[model samples]
Target chain A: MIRFDDVHKSFGPKKVLRGMTLEVPKGESMVIIGGSGTGKSVALKCVLGLIRPDSGTITVEGGEGRDRDAFLARFGMLFQGGALFDSLPVWQNVAFRLLRGSLKRPRDEAKAIAVEKLRRVGLKPDVADLFPAELSGGMQKRVGLARAICADPEIIFFDEPTTGLDPIMAGVINELIREIVTEMGATAMTITHDMTSVRAIADRVAMLHDGVIQWTGPVGQMDTSGDPYLDQFIHGRAEGPIEAVR
Target chain B: MTGVLTGILGGIGATVLGLLAMIGRVTIFLGQTLSHMVRPPFYPREFGSALLTIGWLSLPVVGLTAIFTGGALALQIYAGGSRFDAEAVVPQIVAIGMVRELGPVLVGLMIAARVTSSIAAEIATMKVTEQIDALVTLSTHPMKYLTVPRVLAALITVPVLVGVGDVIGILGGYQVATGQLGFNPAAYLKNTIDFLEPLDVISSLVKGAVFGVIAALMGCYSGMNSGRGAQGVGRATKSAVEAAAVMILAANFLLTGVFFSL
Candidate 1:
């Protein structure tokens, strides 16, 4: 389980996360939905230790931050952009952690593992030999997904997993994400504004606004959540309390 | 007034402390990188690319610069020596000078300009684009995976660049002596070869190794510490080149003193 308790983080005078608290349990898929710049990504980064909060305790399984490497080992992350190494082939990128030691076997063995992971994400074995630049947006995301699960991390964090793809490709990626979460029995925390992805992949959904979680419940109840902010968000209405840019 | 002065002093002290802390972190990271290199998970592709950079790709420019410099040195030595009725010593002096000093220094600067800038720009761009963060997410440490290979490659290959530079420099002097200065080609060749000793070649190669370390370290350190935005990357590349060049020259002087103090 992951828990953030009264987390208060600010960048100078601009408070990004204020008294934020949430918990995600084992084998659960939680998606945090919010408009742009509402600190959704910052929340994920805080969990990953990319940024530290000024005041509050972030604990995993009722334990304080300890054994960072051990903790990090259980976490897999898919960044907003598919940040693959341009110089390496797709196979090396996917099998990176697997080949880190005397477990660093021969090229064939590493490639085989990479191909298996790729196939799991619905990618062809031929794609493993190509560079990331040669792949399309959806294909790269598939490769990114394959790489994230290569180590079979216990907890996975995905940032905007369906932002740039076409509706059809997005649906495919959503299905793949759902299937993988089920296949590995892994807990997932995904942050996206795409309600379609939330509907397809989320077991429970949370809405973040004004630097705090406004509401959270099962995906089936989000439409009738009746909370002003959640209603304003899901219906894409700019009038109620959400301010317009103008 | 006193309180303001104290605050300013405290700020300066904090800045110094920050720099010292950074140095400590870099030292720890360096040790980790060295350890990782000897263990498993070596990337031959990264090493080969760096070798092509710090050694082979840099050769043509180092050669061109050294040859022209050697030719010019021969002419200048001939002109300067004639005043003392010592023009005959040009071949020997040019050979020793090129091997002992200019070859290593020029090649060091060349590698600093070409390799350091390129490395700094590449790494800074990576930092800005979250590629380093991506590596971490992939369960790979950026220092161990990205930095160690390039540094190890530079350490091994730059001495070879220096050795080649030394030879090309000598040939340049030979051309001037045989073609322009009307010296006996065989005699000039004999003087050039016979006047040099083992220590000269060793010192040149040693300088190459030290300069290589300074160049790669400066590049990697500045790049890793680069700030946000494209402007930050531009500054990092500039800083890396300047730091590498200055450090190389400083190292050259120290190595020269140590090598020749006998």
Candidate 2:
């Protein structure tokens, strides 16, 4: 479980997150929907301590002290671009967390786990030996997913998981994400503007606007949420309370 | 005229401030790297690969640069010495020049071009693609995982490369002096051996080590601080080589003053 309490972050003159407040309960898939540059990524990064909040508190599982290495061990992130280590083979990339530092296992065991995780993500064993550059976009996304779940982390963050994929591939990834979160019983936090992905992956939906959650409810109730910002966002209307670039 | 002068002063001030900031950042980064070098979680595999890339693989370019520079120095010394009826000084001058200055300096520059540029480009690309963030998320210290191995490898191996370059360079001069310049082979070899002091060899190796640190640090620093996108990578690579070259030459000058003048 993660909690953000009145988080405020600013980059010089540009105020990205004025006061963002949200709480994600354990074992729930919480998807944050927001337009580009709404500080969605920034908020997620704040939780990971990648970007520190100017004023406020973020606690993971009720622990306020940021023991960086130990803290990071509990969570995995799937970056928008997959962010695979290009120098490494796919298997090594998947087993990166297990190959070094505190979680290090023997090389053989790490490779085996990587292969198994690859299989879980619907990748073949043979694909493990190939480099990321050799893989297709969708395949690379799957590999990224495999890596995120390889350590069986307690929590996973998906940042634009289906951004550059085809609709079918996006659906596949969404489904995979949904299945993985359910199977692992892992707390999931995802940020995306894709309505279809929202429907497919989210157990609960939170709409972010102007650096705060404007609306949040169960997935079934997202349609009827009467908040103007949420309504404008979900309906994809150019003319609404949420400004369409003047 | 008054406004333009103020603008000029402002630009100069900004440039100076930027330079100072960069220097501060590099100093902090270097301190972190040195501290991490002695600490735990050492990645010998990364160190080994870096040694191969920065040290062993640099042999060809270093060799070529040293050999050609040595040969050219011999010809120049011979031609210049003839004016003073001292053409016999070719071997002695070439030996001192190559061992004391040319070998280390040229090899260092070659590293700046080949190794520094490559490192900056690679790491900058990694940053751009969010691989660095991924590394952090995976509970790895990016500085320890990336910078320490490279700086250590360069620190250990550049001196060895310099020693090799010195020997090869002297051989190149010997070939030119005896084979082409009509000097007696035995006399050329004897003169080279007798003229060079142990201090000259030590200074060369020391310069090589210092230059190695500058080269690797500049590359890593530029890459780590690089902005986003392809243009950022290109700029980082360019600035890394430029910084490395300038720092090597500057360090060489100070080192030469310390070794010889002091």
Candidate 3:
């Protein structure tokens, strides 16, 4: 589980996260949804310690600063843009953390792990040797997903996991994320504006607005939920209390 | 008058703050890079690429610059010596000049032009494309994974470039003296060899190392601090080259002073 308590973050004069707080339990999928610039990504980044909050206490479930390294060790991430290294082959990119760090396995074993992860993400073993530029957008996204889960981490963060995909491919990725999260019994936190991805992958949903979590509940309650912010966001309506532009 | 004075004070404060931010960023980058350097499974391919960029590719330019500089230096020294009816001093002075100052400084400047711009452009492009963030999500530290290997390669390889440049520069002097200036080849070579001291060679190599570090440091610093758009990348590349060139020249002057105080 991950917890944020009164987190405040600002970039110069723009305050992105304003006293935001939330909790995500272990062994569940929590998808954060919001309009662009509503701080969904910022919230996720703070949990990963990528961006520190000005004033807040963040911790893994039942653990504190002492468990930082251990906590970091138990997580993986898939960024919105498939950030593949142009300089490395697909297999090497997937196996980067496994083969090139203080925690290294043998090259062959690392390759096998990368191949296996690729397979799980519905890619051929042959594709592992190709560079990212040679792969299609969908294939690259799959590769990114494979690389994220390659470490077999207990907590996974997916930032807009299916934004750029067609519906069919998005559905495939959504199924894969669900399958993997359940298989590892890992806590999964995903941030996205895509509602189709929400339906397919989320066990629970949270909506961020004006730097606060405006609503959060089981996915079943999302449609009938009374919050005007939730209604405006889910229906993709423009003229609500939530302004279209910041 | 008071308002103008206050405005000047505010300008100074803003400059101080900007410098502080830049300093803070560099410190963080170096700390992370060192951490990655020590705790790596190590990427041999990346290290080799860095070596090729900082060392091998830099050689031709350094060599070209050095050779021409040596020829021009020889002519200038000869012309000055002729004013005293002592043109014979050209060979000795050319060798010492190439070994002690021009060899390292010119090679360093050449590398600053080539390697700094390349690094800054490559890294800025990576940032723009989200590749660097991908490294982070993949559990790879970008500083260790990207910056450290390049920095270490520069530190280790640029001195070799300077050494090679020194030989080529002295050869250039020989070419001009024997083929163009009507001096005997054998006598010019002998004078050059006899005039060289080990201290001169050591100082030249030391300058190479310092210049290499400065070049790489500027690239990484500017790249990481780059803004979010196309214009941002351009600015980063421009600043990286300018800073690298300035720092290299400054370091050369300081090194020369340290090696030979008045």
Candidate 4:
């Protein structure tokens, strides 16, 4: 389980996260939904220790201050734009963790595992030799997915996973995320504004607003949650509490 | 008068604060990078790549610049010496100028233009794309994976490059003087060989190493602290080249003062 307790983060005069508190139970898929620039990404980054909170404690699996390297090894993340290493071939990117540090494996074995993961993510074994620039957007996303799951981490983070894909490709990625999360039984936390992605991948939904959780419940109860901000956001209305101009 | 005074004070204060902040940040970054250098999980592959990029590939530019500058210096020195009936001093002056100053300074500036900008742009793009963050997530330190190897390679290789530059520069002068100016090749070579001292060569190599460190350090520092987007990468690259050039020149002056004054 991962928990954020009264997390507050600010950059200069701009307050990004103001006392945000949330919880992700073990083996659950929690999708955070919010309008643009509402600190959804900041919240996720805070948990990952990519961004430190000003005056809050984030406890991961009952430890507030675990060893960073060890803690990071347990989690895998898919960035918004894939974030593949442009200099490396696809297979090298996937097998990066396996090729170095305490988790080092034989080069051949690591390459074989990378190929397997690539296949699992709907890419051909031959695609492993190509650089990230050679692949299409959908293929690059799949490659990013393969790299993320290559380590078989206990926790997975998907940041704007289906943001730039076509609807069909988005659906395919959604299905892939669902299948992977279910099969791996990893605690998945995804942040997306796409309703289709939410419906396909989320067990529970949390709406972030004004640097706090405005509404949170099981996916089925989101429509009838009786919160105006939630209703305005889900229905994609330009009016109500959230000013469209800002 | 009061308003003008306030404005001047505000500008001066802001500049001082900015300088201090930048100094503090660079110092901290240097400490972190040096600390990572002594720790485990060194990447030999990355180090080898850096050595090739900073050392071997830089030879062509360094050679071209040194040769042309040396030839031009010989012509200028010969012309100037004729005014005082000291035309025979061309070989000695050309050799000392190439070995003691021009060779190292020109090579350092070339490195700032080429290697420093390239390093900054590459790392800044990686940062913009979140590859640096991804490296952290993969249990790799960016300083170790990126900065240390490049810095170490620069420290190891730039002195050798300076030595090569010095020799090529002297040979260029020799070619110009013997072939064009009707000078005896053997006598010119002997004059150049006799004029150059061990101290001059040692100072040149030391300057080369210092310039290399400054260039690589500025590149890495600008890159790791880049802002965001394409504009950020461009700014980082520009700032890195500027800083490296300035620092190299400043270091050269200081090193010269220290070495020659003694």
Candidate 5:
């Protein structure tokens, strides 16, 4: 479980998150939907401490302060671009955490876990030895997904999980994410503007607009929410509360 | 005239402030790197890889630069000494010049161009791709995983590379003087060996280590703080090499003054 209380973040003259507050309960897949530059990524980064919120408290599992190493270990992230280490082979990228630091395991054991995770993400075992550059875009996303779930994290964050993938591949990723979250019973938070992904993966939907959550409800309620911003975003209309021109 | 004076003064003031801020940031970065050296999670594998990249792979370029410079120095010294009827001094001058100044300085500059740029570009690209953030999420410190290894490798191996460069440079001078400059092989060898002092070699190595730290630190600093996108990476790489070269030259001047002023 996570909660952001009055999170306000700004970059110089640009205020990205203004008095924004939201929550994701345990074992729920919460997908945040927003148009470009609406601070969706910024909000997620704030919780992860990649970007510090100017004024706010983000509490995870009921505590505002936790050991950074231990706190980060409880969660995994799939970056927008997959963010695989190009210097490393696919297996090493998946086994990165286990190959070093406090979570280190034997090389063979870590490789085994990496292979298993790759399989879970619909990747062949042979794909484990190739470099990230050698993989297709969809394969890279799946590899990112595999790496994210490698540690069996209690929570997982997916940032634009299906961005840059074809519709069919995007659907495959969405399905994989849904299956993983359900099977692992992990709390999930994904950010994207892909309505197709939303329908496939989200248990609950929250629409971000003007640095605040404009609408939050079950996935089924998303269609009839009637909030102009949410309706405009989900419908992909050029004219509405969210103007095409900033 | 008054407006021009004000404009120039304001520009100078802003430049000075910008320089001070940069220095402050670099000092803090160095302090963080040093502190992490003593912390847990030491990464020997990364350090080893850095050694190969920064040290072993750098041999060809460093060797070529040193050899050519040494040969050129030999020819100039012979020509200059001939005018004074002191052509015999070629070996002594070449030995001192290569071992004391040219060897370390040339090697340092070469590393700046080669190793520093590579490190900056690689790290900057990694940052652009968000691999750095991934490292953080995986419970790893990016500084430990990335910066510390490269810095440590440079500190440990640049001196060794300098030593190798010095020998190769002296060989270059020997080849030119004996094979082409009409100097006797045995006599030139004896002169070079006798003219060198232990302090000269020590100073050269010390300069190598210091220059190594500067080059690698500048690379890592520029990289870690790089802006987003491809252009950001390009800028970080260019600035890193430029800063490393300037710092190496400056540090060399100060170090020379310290070592020889006595």
Candidate 6:
């Protein structure tokens, strides 16, 4: 449902995305894998218009020409860090979209939805009133996830959904994401380098290197892709086509 | 020696260019903030909170600064005027000075030190944490939600604070004059009231409004453009206060010239 066409983005002398082109089919979880600083985040940001691509077009079901608010209404994002509004309590963060603007609902209704979403993300209802700072890292990520899915968006973007969590918590998050995407039938785009998370959450896998998608196929095909960069990355080998250091 | 001179000239040129570029960016930010302010989806809740933080919470500091400065100004005027046997002129001078200059300027500077720094640091931290991007992804405009409310609150409230400061400052002068300087309380109050023209009060309020806008805008601009991490936040806060203080003083001078010249 989302398409990136010849996206090229540069920051001064550093060219982050050079001709990155990818398509995410509707109702499928597409996980983008890349090493550090390979512009994975930038690519997702381009789709959201958070970072304008220097020369390219990103269209979400031909919604690029729509009103900015309308265009953004179709999607939700969970940042690398939870990115929860620290000033707000957990429930407020989840209900943020519902409490303001075009999607506004009554305060009670919004709070109910927030509680339900929090529950769906494996959080207790009692955690709703607590502030984000009171939550642990894994709990914070769950809260972030709850916020992302609270609006029932048509598409969801997860940026490193399991970065700082323990292995079991990461697995839990990956499973939750997988179940949510399947149950909601939402198009999902997640960017991460975690092989475990990829195996758990992705229907399709795309390996990014040197600002371009070097290999892409079904998650089952990832192991035998034979592309040096993908093989090196998935294997976590220090010696390969992908350099250990910049 | 020749190379060093060329290097110095290059450095000076770069500094001027940087300053001009900064001014240009801030001007653009101000325009965007104004445009957002006039648009729909007004955030009254955020504005109300901002009014409390910027206006109500600021009263104590503004009052303290004004009262102390007024008393100090009275002492200095008494000392200086005594040289020419003009100690009796303290009430008139203090009233004029507090109403026209010190009230607005000192309050503005205090806000720069307190409110401006806090705003910059908070927004910068939000930026670093990616909450700003989250706001965008939620179909909310950061300028409308964050900048406009604070700026509008400052615009509405700082003038009122300046008026309060002017009165408290005059009262402080009266206290010092009547109690310690051995002037009659009624006469001191009368001279102070008579010396302040309506125009002087208006000028003071106008200066307050301008200084408020400067303080709030500088804080928001530095914050929204801050780099990454704790150091970026610290730098943004420092620069915001510096810019606001300098701008308030400079605007004070220009405003004083404008009001008096007319």
* Model 3 Cα lDDT, one tens digit per residue, B1-262: 9999999999999999997887687778777777777885477778898998788888778888989988888888888999999899888988888988888888888887888888888888789877776666555667876788888898989899999999998898888888888999888998888888888899989998988888887898788778877888999999999978887888888899999885
RMSD of each: 3.9, 1.0, 2.5, 1.3, 1.1, 1.0
Q: List clashing residue pairs in candidate 1.
A: A101-A104
Per-residue lDDT for B134-203 in model 4, tens only?
8988888899999999998998889989999999999898889988887899999999888889999999
Ten residues in sequence with the least summed lDDT for candidate 4 chain B: B25-34
Stretches of model 6 off by over 4 angstroms after superposition: none
Stronger candidate by DockQ (3 vs 5)? 5
Q: Write one digit per residue (lDDT tens) for candidate 5, span B100-149.
A: 89999999999999999999999999999999999989989999999999
Question: Cα deviation in Å at residue B230, candidate 5?
Answer: 1.2
How far does residue A185 in candidate 6 sit from its true spot (Å)?
A: 0.3
Per-structure clash totals for the candidates: 1, 0, 0, 0, 0, 0
lDDT minimum window of 10 residues, candidate 1 chain B: B136-145
Tens-place lDDT per residue, model 5, A1-246, is: 889889999999999998888889999999999988989999889888899999988888845354788788788899999999999999999999899877899999999999999999999999999999999999999999999999898999999999999999999999999999999999999999999999999999998888888899999999988899888888888988677974
* Residue A82 lDDT in candidate 5: 98
> Which regions of candidate 2 deviate over 4 angstroms?
A62-66
lDDT of each: 0.85, 0.93, 0.85, 0.92, 0.93, 0.93
**How well is each residue in A168-219 modelled by candidate 6, as lDDT tens digits?**
9999999999999999999999999999999999999998889988988999
Clashing pairs in 5: none
Scored against the true structure, residue A127 in model 1 reaches a CA lDDT of 95
Kindly list the per-residue Cα lDDT of model 2 for residues B133-185, writing each as its tens digit: 89989998888999999999999899999999999999888888888999999
Interface RMSDs of the predictions, in order, are 2.4, 0.7, 2.7, 0.9, 0.7, 0.5
For all the predictions, what are the DockQ values? 0.44, 0.90, 0.44, 0.80, 0.89, 0.94
Task: Point out the higher-scoring one by TM-score: 1 or 5.
Answer: 5
